[model samples]
Target: MLIRLIYASRAKSLGPMDVKDILESSRRNNTAAGVTGALCLSNGVFLQCLEGDRVVVNALYHRILLDPRHDNPAILDFEEIIHRQFGAWSMGLVSTVADNQALFLKYSTGAQFDPYQMRPQALRAFFTELMGNTRWLA
Candidate 1:
């Protein structure tokens, strides 16, 4: 069955090139694993949505828990979906750059993007809107 998992985590230490390295590795690894998703990094928090097979995604999430770079990982949403929202890309990076500030604030509860404070439905809505409007990093 196809499943989508949304999770939030704080970054242990975000280096200047860390996000770049993450995108590269995620694109490469997720492509081979048949996973598609978008990763958003803002305000020292990582909000990511991963979609794929149930067992594969579950295993992937568990592996993420072991990664030292991420801290306090929390699953925000998980459900079976009829189709993938990010089918075109293996892994997409969403940035909180200047142009995307307003977009991010729309769903944010305060001045910063805090997915942990967002409800599951709000998180789902955020991603649904994000897929079409946000400027993605390469």
Candidate 2:
């Protein structure tokens, strides 16, 4: 059955480029594993949603837990959503904002640097934005 999984993690203090490298690697690996999802990182927190067979989703989670860049990772949203915000990505698609701002919001712009407070609405908005950016073309 198709399942939707969402998880978040705190970064040790990775810069934008470092975050990009990690996300890029994840995208490549997730694609190879036949999983699909949208990923977002901001305020040192990562938000990701994976959709696929239960086995694949769980496997992906396991792999993430092994990554050193993250710590105290938490499963935020795991229920099945009625519809997918991302319909095109295969494996994964990742986006990052380097500040206290979110990927989604009234500003729709995020801080390029510095640690920002993690407000609930801003973070959620960012995750939603990541979902909205799903690559149907892929």
Candidate 3:
């Protein structure tokens, strides 16, 4: 029983090394737990998607909920999936502080990437497109 979970949260101040550390930890832990996902950080906000067994994904999400680096974590979408959309990555990462103008425009209605304002399918579309376009951390 595979599932996909999408979530958004407000992040704390993060330097490049902090993001790298987070991604490395995620890659290591997710690999061990047989989970895959993508994480996007933009303007102190985080958008992430995780796919794997229901138990594994859910447990990972709960752990993310407890992490002090982010606040007000909210699950945006959760559903059973036929296949992994992010199968190639243990944990893919993107930061809007970089060159992601097109990505932001497509997903954001205004000048910011606020997942809370998006419709459900629109939110899912954003993640899907992100997974397809962005290079994952290796």
Candidate 4:
């Protein structure tokens, strides 16, 4: 069955190169694994949505828990889905650039983007709106 998993985690001292390496590896690895998703990084937090087969996505989430770069990982949403929302991307990166500030704030609870504080429906809406915006990194 198709499933979507949304999770948030605090970053543990990441540099530009580290983020680049993550995107590169995610694109390569996720494509091979038939997983697709979008990653949002803002305010030292990582909010990611992974969509694919149930078992594959679950295994991927477990692997994420083992990564040293992430701290305080929390799964915000998980459900069986009829279709993939991010079918075109193996792994898309959504950066908190200037142009996208308002978009991020719209769904955010406070001045910063914190998916952990957002309800599941709000997170889903945020991603849906994000997909329509052209400002994301990829």
Q: Which tens-of-lDDT digit does each residue in 8-49 have in candidate 3?
A: 899876666788888989999999999998888876888888
How high a TM-score does candidate 2 get?
0.64
CA lDDT of every candidate = 0.91, 0.60, 0.83, 0.91
The local distance difference test score of model 1 is 0.91
Superior by lDDT: candidate 2 or candidate 4:
4
- Stretches of candidate 3 exceeding 4 Å from the true structure: 135-138
What's the distance in Å from true for residue 58, model 4?
0.4
Candidates, ranked, TM-score: 4, 1, 3, 2
Which residue pairs show backbone clashes in model 4? none
lDDT of 4 by residue, 1-138 (tens): 999999999999787688899999999999999999999988899999999999999999998898888899999999999999999999999987888888888998898877899999999999999899847685
| Regions more than 4 Å wrong, model 4 | none
Whole-model lDDT, model 4:
0.91
Candidate 1 weakest ten by summed lDDT:
13-22
Higher-lDDT candidate of 3 and 4: 4
> Over the stretch 7-75, how does candidate 2's per-residue lDDT look in tens digits?
777777666577567667766776786667776554566666787778888887988888787787777
Better of 2 and 4 by TM-score: 4
Model 4 steric clash total: 0
